[model samples]
Target chain A: MRITCPICGERDRREFYYVGDAVALERPDADAPPEAWHGYIHLRDNPCGVTRDLWYHEQGCAAWLVVTRNTATHEVLGVALASDEKGEAR
Target chain B: MVELAPKSPLAGLVPVTVGRMTLTEVDLGRLTSVAPYRGRDEGLSEALKAAHGIAAPEPGRVTGRVAARASGRDEACAIWFGQRMFLLAGADPDPALAQYAALSDQSDGWACARIQGRGATQVLARLTPIDLRPAAFRRGHTARTELQHMAASITRLGEDDYLILVFRALAGTLVQDVRQAMQGVAARGGG
Candidate 1:
């Protein structure tokens, strides 16, 4: 798979590391119940359709990216800087 | 006090001239890394310019003075490494930048090498994923990318000249890899 880094442009997927869902960026409340915190940290949706995920461009621009992709087809729907998510919708 | 000559990271291996390509070790003096505080990029740039007389380059760009003589002590090449981060080489960077940016002394942390000649681009293309095509990676373009799985910063100084910087610890490996790659390119007649 090819991921387009917002800073370095398109590059081979081998250069990046898959960091799981983008939701990981949102942390659970510190005052939440243990079970709620556990679910936030340990449990994740293994959806087969389009989903937003996080990728670390470890070998490129070193930017964290939010990649919208289809899990079933392995096709990338869109990509944006994780920092830019609040400013733009894919 | 007894003194010893400085040995390059690729000591005894570089200054290699094979066919139309040469991989030479260059000592880029006083390397410094500057990363602005959050939302302070513009401020950092202005400060750098006001103090050093050199403006910070934009992302994926490099700015440096072209000096005819190597003794020009103030010549500094600042290559953008990422968002709000730049790698500054050549002479002492303004220490005042520390107020607005995180400054790190990188003088001994990196090894600088220059690839130049007829087939220099082809040799580099074999090792890095960055596009070496002239039209795309034009002169003065800088990119931080992976070179054979090692993080590297590359700057195009000219059509056939490139400045490559890698971690000092990996300098030996980098030189060996580039030499082997250059041999392959030469064997193929600049393939």
Candidate 2:
């Protein structure tokens, strides 16, 4: 897989590390019930179609990225900087 | 009182040469990293320009100062690491920028080396998975990438000249990897 970093341009996948689902960034309420906290920390949906994931360019650019990809085919649908709330990418 | 002499990270390793290429460590003076707080990048740039008489370059690019450093013939340069981040060598941090940015001294954290020769790009291509063609990765272009599993920053200074920076702890490993890659390029050229 190849990831085109917004700042560093295209680079090999080995330079990046998979950071799991992008949704994890939104933290659940701290005062919520025990079951709600458990679900937020340990449970995740296994989507088959398009999925949004977070990736860190550990060895390239050092920028966090949001990668939309197809689970079945492993095709990358899109990529964006995780810091960019507007979802802009080059 | 005791006096101490500064030693380069590669002080013990002999400079490597393969074909016409040479890899030698360069001791940089007053290296600093500047990072602006959120939404303060524009102000930081202006402050740097006003104080240092130069503007920071955009990401993936490098700009050189008009004056050369006392230790080297090459003009002093600043490399852009990423958004709101820059690495300046041969220049001191602007005290005026403290209001807009955070500054850190990086002179000892990184080890820099200059690579030059007829086949310098070929050897670099073998180590880094980047399209190093002259047209695509033109002069002044810079990138932070992985080399032999170690993080590195590469800046193209000229057609055959490049400045590579790696962590000080991994300097030996990086040089060793470059030596082996250069040998491969030389062997191919000789054959």
Candidate 3:
């Protein structure tokens, strides 16, 4: 698979560093249970559909990006910089 | 400088040594060997947190030292980041490799890059809000933040020091963006 970084241009899939889902999660309060902090920091739902995720071009300029992809196919639905709050990712 | 290996990927821009062999390049001279990089893709957040560190005898306004451990050439510079290794070299850098520094703010380490050369400063000035002046990001310090179109952290190794940070997803375009910015500087100079 291939993805293009707005700053670096076209590159192989290997160049990127995947961050997980971007759908906002709730934060646990300071006195919250220990499991809450662990879940928020280290857990993922691992859904298998169109999902919004965060990725970085670790090999390039290291831009933060929001990517839409299909987990089952490894096919990227769309890509955009995290800075782009409202652009069509595809 | 000694002769170069015929099959080096960076046969033109710089002559550096990787592992135990001196490689060739088109622009720079043949020099020492450098190492390859493997990015933090799987379990990155954890590794990143580990890499970020602090600086002791803080770098002044404009000072830095060359880190030439494994890489053969006079390229890579070893930055003092508390207890981390920050390598910077455009000659033949593999962005895929780990390039990070620990932060005082968060557990996650920030990714960074050392982009040097004459036009490097001017190139960054075009996309960032921070002053490129020596006073703003002097030699030994590192700053984590976002710029123009990306979320990144930058550091100053010297006058041209830049520890540009962005998500690994956008790593591919870093060189070109800076290149285009440099081109702008060149054009302005010509004009």
Is model 3 an incorrect, acceptable, medium or high docking prediction?
A: incorrect
> DockQ score for model 3, please?
0.04
Please list the C-alpha lDDT of all candidates, in the order they appear: 0.81, 0.80, 0.47
Provide interface RMSD per model, one decimal. 1.3, 1.3, 11.9
lDDT of 1 by residue, A1-87 (tens): 788888888788878899998877776678989988888689898898999899988876788999999999999989988888844
Q: Which CAPRI level is candidate 1?
A: medium
In model 1, the clashing pairs are none
In terms of lDDT, the poorest run of 10 residues in model 2 chain B is: B66-75
Q: Estimate candidate 3's alpha-carbon lDDT, on a 0 to 1 scale.
A: 0.47
Model 3 spans > 4 angstroms off: A1-90, B1-112
Candidate 1, B168: how far from true, in Å? 0.6
Over B86-190, each residue of candidate 1 has an lDDT whose tens digit, in order, gives 877785777778888999898888888888888889888888877778888988888888888789988887887888889989988888898898899999998
Which stretch of 10 consecutive residues in model 2 chain A shows the poorest summed lDDT? A81-90
